[model samples]
Target: MAQIVISRFAPSPTGRLHLGHAFSALAAHDAARAAGGRFLLRIEDIDTTRSRPEHVAGIFDDLAWLGLTWDEPPLFQSQRMPLYGKALSDLKALGVLYPCFCTRAEIAAEVAASGFAPHGPDGPLYPGTCRALTPDDRAARLSRDAHSWRLDVDAALALTGPLVWHEGDRAIPADPRIHGDVVLARKDLGTSYHLSVTVDDAAQGITDVVRGVDLFDATHVHRLLQALLNLPTPLYHHHPLLTAPDGARLAKRHGAPSLASMRAEGVDPVTLVADLRARR
Candidate 1:
């Protein structure tokens, strides 16, 4: 038998736990429990514009209703801003971070003019508008106050082992250019997803990350960030996503019954477990 250390379920508290979310949470909890390992929960509420206290409360209720328990007081992303700031400062000190000034509209226009189709999760690749700026030019852009920090792809790539994430068959490589200088901090918040998640996973000592297949690509970026920051790389298992009868994978917009909603309708906890087993 293999030894299990730790696993986690991190859900954005912006929405309720739908079927997809329930499956993910149950998968993590069940795997950890079966292995006699620790299972943890994290509230990914960094996107303040969408995250609500009510939603966070609902997540707790839904998970409890499903008979899932997590170790530790649930980790909240918003409260960890200071840690993220420190990581960003470290990267900046190493000259791997730079500021990005292009707005969404400007990037769109540039993409349209270039006649290139958008690819990947974030749409069109950023054209490196700020990559070649001189010190004075950089200072001028900073003065305009329209910039957000970005990882210098060239420098970031030179730092290896962080960009490697394992799928079942093989390891996938993350080239920073594919992600195109993601924003580490935005004007709206003190930290970005890349920075916060990498820092938190390392700080919490997560050994394995179990989540939906949709996030598989994101692992590449996470691996890169983990390497750049010199954090331990956790094993990843991206499971199949639950889909609606219509064949679309379950999503927040479905309004189709959620796991909590199913519980409210009186479905037994054993039933959920059976359903998970059937799907697998």
Candidate 2:
């Protein structure tokens, strides 16, 4: 008997579902359907400040209008804070997490003053400013100021040694240090994307992690977290992003027409699905 293939398309409810989102959701859904397996939907509403209930409703409407269906009701990240907390606690027990006190402005100033900040997939990597804080200093600051919990990548790598993850038939080496000490939980939200997604994927038994190639770099960090948390690493499928006629990637910021707008304009869902499948 073959192993069951489970895939997911977890989208944040920060904005309307655009063309790129459709492409990604369809890719994950089609892959699962093709394998006679399960496709799951997850609402990544960890950013409480920006996440909107209306946008989440829009996501469901858009995916349904595109003729896509999920195996279960969507998993909302906002409701899984306890699970993320447990993962963070486990990492902390392993001495692989520390409080990061640097604000965004501070991080930028440090990077700018360095004059040669090494760039990662997300632009200038964090400078590890708070990684060297003494226990007393950390305690003192914690008493008054807010701080994020960051994964001590160097320490984590020391424990896990080296790691690799499967992307199709190829084994890719993970280089999570490129991200420096990534925040596992924020001062305000209490959970970060890296921590929540890694935990949820495992919890949901997601066997095949499918998403846009833009998140390929994020897999390195996710793989490391899996090792530290004693979770199973899933097979990855980082598909190419759909682009507009101008050859630029479709994005919410780029004013890409949303699926809702297309629906309102009387575009046929079947025709749209066929067009997207052709692009793949």
Candidate 3:
């Protein structure tokens, strides 16, 4: 018997789904369908401040309208805080997490003043300003000020030794240190994207992670998290992002039209799906 293949398309419900989202969902759905496996939907709504109920409803409606069906009811990130909290506690026991009290302005000033800040895929990497805080200072700050919990990447790498994860048939080496003490929990929310997604994938028994290539760099950090948490590392397939006719990446910020708008303008879902499949 062959191992079951499970993949997911997780989207944050902060805005309406666009053509890029459709392409990603269809890719995952097709991959699972080809393998006679399961395709799951996950609502990445951990950013409660921005996530809207109306947008969440629209996601389900749009996916259904596109003739895509998921095997299981969608998993919402907001509902899985306890699981994330437990993961944080486990990492805390390992002594690899530290409270980072730096505000955004403070971080910016530090990075600007350094004049030679290390850059990561996302831009200038965070300088570990709070990582060196003494126990007494950390305790005092925790008592009065709100702070985020950051992963001590250097410390974590020391314990895990080295880590690698598979992307398709190739085993890629993970260099999570480039990210430099990524926050696992924010001041307002108890969980961050890195922490929530890693924990949820394991809890949901995901076998393959299918998403756009934009998230390829994030896999390095996720791989490290999996090792530290003693969780299974899933196979990763980062498909190319769908771009507009202008050759730019499709983005809501760029005023990319939503699937809902396209549907209302008399575009046929079947034809749209065929076009997307052909592009792939």
Candidate 4:
């Protein structure tokens, strides 16, 4: 018997959905539907500061307009804080998580002074300033300064043996250090993207992750998290991103037209879906 594919389209409720967002959502929806499997919708609204109720409504509205529906009611990240807290606690107990006291300015300054800034998927790699903190030093900083928790990737890799993840037919070696010591939880948010995404994907029984190519590198970190937490690793599908006419990736930051705007302008949902499928 073949494995039943369970996929998801998780979007943050920070802005309106765009053509690029439609592309990804449709890909995941179609993938599961084509396989007679299940597709899920997860509202990644952990960043409460920017996650507005209107944007969440717009996401559901736009996805409906695109003729996309999930297998069940959507899962909201805001309602699942305790699960994240538990995952963080588990990682902390594993002794692979450490407090990161370096601010953005301090990290940038240190990387600049070294004059050899190696970039990661998120940007300039975090210089392991806090990773090397002595127990007394870390304790002193923790007494007063607010700090984020980072995974000591080197330490984590040592705990696991010869890890690899699948994307379609390829078996890519897991190299979590490509992202350096990634933050597991934030002082304010109580969780970071890497941790929440890994935890939620497992909790929802997501058998496949269908997203953009931009997140391809982030999978390395996710695979490590899966191993550390003893969660099942899902097959990943990093599809190409829809691009603008000038060859730039279609994005809200680049003024991409939103699906809601198109819907208001009298665009037919069936016609748009057909067009998207044809282009695929």
Candidate with top TM-score is: 3
Name the runs in model 2 displaced over 4 angstroms: none
lDDT, residue 93, model 2 = 98
lDDT of each residue in 109-218, candidate 2, tens digit only: 99999999988878898988888888999999988998999999999999999999999889999999888888899999888989999999999999999899999999
List the global CA lDDT of all models.
Answer: 0.81, 0.93, 0.94, 0.93
Per-residue accuracy of model 1 over 1-280 as CA lDDT, tens digit each? 6656688999998777787888888888877787789999999999989999999999999888777888899999988888998998988987888888778788788878888754657777777777778878899878877678877777877755335676645777765566777788886787888788889999989888888888777777788788778898888888899888789888878675776778778889788777875785
Task: Point out the higher-scoring one by TM-score: 2 or 3.
Answer: 3
Off by over 4 Å in 4: none
Pairs with steric clashes in candidate 1: 162-223, 162-227
Q: What is the lDDT, from 0 to 100, of the residue 159 in candidate 3?
A: 94
Steric overlap count per candidate: 2, 0, 0, 0
The TM-score, computed over Cα atoms with residue i paired to residue i, of candidate 2 is 0.98
Q: Give candidate 1 regions above 4 Å deviation.
A: 1-4, 161-163
Ranking by lDDT: 3, 2, 4, 1
lDDT of 3 by residue, 1-280 (tens): 7779998989999999999999999998998899999999999999999999999999999999999899898999999899999999999999999999899999999999999999998889989899889999999999999899999999999999989999999999999987888999999999999999999999888998989999999999999999999999999999999998899999899888899999999999999999999999
Model 3 CA lDDT for position 139: 96
